[model samples]
Target: MTADTDATDAGAAATDVTEPGATPTATDTTVTPATSAHPGPDAAAPAARSGRRRRVGGGLAVVPLLAFVALAFGIPALAMLDGAFTVKDPVTGASSYGVANVTASVQGAYLTALIGSVKLSAFSAAIGVVCGLLLAQAVVTSRSRVLREAVLTASGVLANFGGVPLAFAFVATLGNSGFLTRRLDLTDKGWSLYSFSGLTLAYLYFLIPLMVLTITPALEGLRTQWREAARNNGATNAQYWRHVALPVLAPSLLGGFVLLFGSAFAAYATAAAMVGSSIPLVTLQIADALAGNVLVGQENVALALSLDMVLVAGLVMAVYLPLQRRSARWLA
Candidate 1:
């Protein structure tokens, strides 16, 4: 056989063969892409796969998040909303869905609880925001290193130290049998740290620190140039605040009050511990209902209580709806 040796020929594959006297021919096709030095399909595969994996990974985050909310928050919320208008049949233990299930007595209790909660929360938030603003201003404008550090350190501690322990601390400091009460000999007119008024004071203790922390950032956002410009234009401190600082800080302050109100409204542990069965907070009421009273079935009452909570929270949110629509980003 006459052996043809041409590298360009389709059948001439190997110029250097391992076997002696054997030449392997290429197939009847040209291989163009497989040996491309720049980028073959395989080399690009990893990057393309990585791109796809990133998209899938990012999309997967939402799935677990939504699923978590659905399983835990959504399901329970729906159940609560349903319970608001549904009642258990005393005889068969079947739920009877009707608007009438939100009876006059339940409605009264809800309204009473809501009014009390809002009053306490509003008073607490107002006091908190005012004190926090002053404290933050003092800290931010302080020239003393020691005082600044002390303020920051105390703020951090008190901001986190709320609820039951906070309640008990007040009880020790200001209650009828408190240290100060004995020292001052005001046993007849001692501070009541367990009553509604006292609870408002306790709420202020933590909430003020929270407001200070929240609004400090906003205060720091104020430009030194603006204040200097105002001063250069011969504006008084009050005028500077009225014209510039107030305008900028008002939204944040209002938003903080909204947040603080929501917090205080839902607080249970402090309120419950301070008064136990003596005071009837909505959260405490919900807990009581969950215990399954012989008169009011557990599920039925828990549902109603949940509904009551949603309604009160909804009302508080409604109060902030205008603000929500306006400076939502700032508020958030």
Candidate 2:
């Protein structure tokens, strides 16, 4: 009886074990392979493909802008380059490529005009940066929104107010026998409205407003916390500005100067109307060259001058862009 019981118990235990090639019961659990948490090469391929497609689409969208730039700026630049290098003889109508025009553009009257333009631009930009920075600070610190808006609106209007009308306005107010000139007796003081000093004053009229506009956003970007932190660190107002504010603002100030310099350098109409050919300026020189007022067949020289201006502008941009990038990193 004991042997029979042992054999039956062993047979029961053997029946409970699952064997190979046997069907699994309803309650039997099967083991599965573990999955990784991170995405594999195959999983990331679609995302990479999607990013590539977006880049391609963005490139396609920029095609029209590229075409416009080619037509508007590139073609003109190429023509100017060709004209600048190509010399045409007046006697025989013969044409040759050389750097004569470029060379001539940097000598004699051209050289004087270039120097004058640089001086005027530098002076005006320096003054404008100072005055504009002060005015912007005032506007930014004001409690009245109406006053701020009014100044900003006036600045916008005045900044765009240039050319013939601006020249006329200045002449009417400051010219010989004008209302202000007569009342103030400015002529007796040897103040000539058509002189270099007068031109600089006129430039300031617009440059100040432009500076205000350029620097206002930067002024507003100054954080209250920065001031509070400086005060907490036992810094006085002057020390705070010297150590912190000026350093942070230096880039923006430089950028504004570049902007003003470029504006003053390229200005033609106001100077032409106010001072005529009395004051030497690159823009006036260019006009004289193009209109054949100074000499016949000097258009190539004008193109060369244009090239010089473009190079100067490019240099200014090179400086400005880096400063702008640095300013953005801090302010943003």
Candidate 3:
């Protein structure tokens, strides 16, 4: 009877240890291969389908932008490229593909205009970069919030204040019978409003502000810890800037210079209104060719010039984009 009672107690203990719905302990908490692999086909298929749907939705969202770019830029670029390589036959009055226009565009008068344009762009961009950098640095170091806001607001306004209106404003202020020209008698000092020097002066009005806006953000990205570290190492102001600040700022500066150069190179309305045929800018030559002022039915020459401008601008942007990326790595 004692042995039978002991067996009954042992059977109850075993039942308790193997309880059907009991909570798992630490040792039993590990994941099994079946549980780790997947939640079964039903759960996985829905999740995969949802992910694919999201990717498709995202791609669909950008379709309009892609279409707009294709129509606006890609088609026009292709048309110009085709025109650049095409010529009209004088005897047959039929268009044929050739490189005569391209050759004409790169030699003699057209070549001179191209070289002049490059020189003007280089000069204006150099000056703009220097002045703009100084202004941006000054704005960055200022303590007054109102002053900083005011400078930035003014810069935003000035940077975009270009085109024919800019030309008109400069004319009103500095034309022979105009405000400052009359007050200061600049004409007597050999100043001409239609000269290349005059055009560069007008360009600087907008270019400096553009530089200020671009470089200000770059200046702000500079880490204060860098200056502090430099000082801790007994570096002077000049030494700090040369060794720490400038090296970091170089990419931004170079990128801004390239942007300015391209801006000056592609400028049309201001140069057209102010100087016209007086200055042999590539833009003016293009306009003349287009209007049949130079060569009628030979608009291919104009397209060739356009293609050259595009190539130059493309090169500048190519340089700028890499520099901008380098600057971002540091700034970020």
Candidate 4:
């Protein structure tokens, strides 16, 4: 019996060892609970691929707008630049490249037209600044929200309200046979609608509104505390404006003026409609040059004038951008 018990014990020990080292079945080969619960590389790879796809989709969305701008604004600008230096041969009708057209554009009647545009822009912008500042200040100082909202809304609309329609409105209001003109009979007083003075007067319609839109925020930025502090320091209202307000608002005011100057300088349709060929504006001269009315085959001169206008506008922006940043520092 002792021998038999030893044999059975030995058999049990052998069975235990074999069971612990047994091969897995088909069920064990399939994913276990822990293995299924924790995903592996294949599972995470799809997530990474989806994230990449989202980024690529976002990039593709901007392509249409970029293409549009390249075709619309970029292509036109390049064409104008190329045409500016190109001179067409009168004999062969072939195009040759030279800066002679540019030189010609900068002298003679074209020069006069450029100067006129500058003077008109300067005069209009100056008047608009002063008048618009007053209007903006008045609007800001008002107690009524209705007044402020109404003024701002009107200003926004009027600021963008230039072109042939604006010209027509001014004509109906102040032309020789117009309502106000007929009522006032301003022609007897040396008033003429088809003149530079009349064009400047019409330009003020939109210019003042533009100034108001630009300057209203700056005027509002003039804190009540500053005025109160000035008054408490025994400074009069006039003194406050001269010392405190003027200095504080100078950058914004000047920036607004520069913006207005550029607006007036680039204006073509309104000036064209109002003055026609009577006044010699650079824009009008350009139209004439392009239409082959003044010296045929001088289309390059038109492009040169356009280049000059672009340069002027560029210079204005260069000055205005720095002043604008400075103004934001104070307002912020």
lDDT of 2 at 270: 96
Ranked candidates (TM-score, high to low): 2, 3, 4, 1
Can you list the residue pairs that collide in candidate 4?
Answer: none
lDDT of each: 0.75, 0.94, 0.90, 0.89
lDDT of 3 by residue, 221-249 (tens): 99999999999999999999999899889
Best by lDDT: 2
Each candidate structure's TM-score, on Cα atoms with residue i matched to residue i, is 0.74, 0.88, 0.88, 0.79
Mark the regions of model 4 whose C-alpha exceeds 4 Å error after superposition. 1-68
Error of 3 at 103 (Å): 0.7
The digit string of per-residue lDDT tens for model 2 on 19-86 reads 99898776566678999998999999999999999999999999999999999999999999999999
| Residue 59 displacement (Å), model 3 | 0.8
Model 1 local distance difference test score: 0.75
* Local lDDT at 214 for model 4: 91
Report the C-alpha lDDT of model 4 over 125-228, residue by residue, as the tens digit. 99999999999999999999999999999999999999999999989988978898889988899988888888998889899999999998888888889989
Clashes (N, CA, C under 3 Å) per candidate: 0, 0, 0, 0
Model 4 root mean square deviation, Cα atoms = 8.8
lDDT, candidate 1, at 254: 82
> Can you write out model 1's per-residue Cα lDDT over 163-228, one digit (the tens) per residue?
789778877877788888678876677456667778888888788888888888778778888899
- Can you give the lDDT of residue 197 in candidate 4? 84
